[model samples]
Target: MKAKVYVTLKPSVLDPQGKAIKHSVELLGFSGISDIRQGKYFEIAIEGPLNVDQAREEAVRMAHDVLSNPIIEDFRVEIEE
Candidate 1:
């Protein structure tokens, strides 16, 4: 089984990095971008006899506890088998 986790900052939080990227993009001649947000992606390989549900549960727990900061970030998990 494999798990994919996407961690992102909350909407209320300021994203200086994202803003810098957006500025760079505009400087590169890309236009019409209203906003940008920075985030983290993690791919975890589960090596066990766990089923899809179990893997999803484990991934969600790990995402919530270890992969993201609950105070300023949110995360979602996906499982593949």
Candidate 2:
């Protein structure tokens, strides 16, 4: 089984990288681009003794404890179907 974690900054937090990308797009003559945001994606392969449900649970825990910063980021976990 495998799991994916999508990590993103909370809306209230400032995203400098996203801002820079937006600025670059405008400088390149792109118009009407309103907003941009940057985020991270992680794919984890699960091996060993755990079953599918257990692996999914562990994946969610990893997202909360290790994959994302609780203070300024939010994360969503999805198990492979």
* Winning model by TM-score: 1
| Each model's lDDT | 0.94, 0.92
TM-score of 2: 0.84
Per-model TM values vs. the true structure: 0.97, 0.84
lDDT of 2: 0.92
Cα deviation at 56, candidate 1, in Å, is 0.5
- Over 21-77, each residue of candidate 1 has an lDDT whose tens digit, in order, gives 999999999999999899999999999789999899999999998999999999989
Show how many residue pairs clash in every candidate, following the order shown: 0, 0
- Runs of candidate 2 with Cα error greater than 4 angstroms are none
TM-score for model 1? 0.97
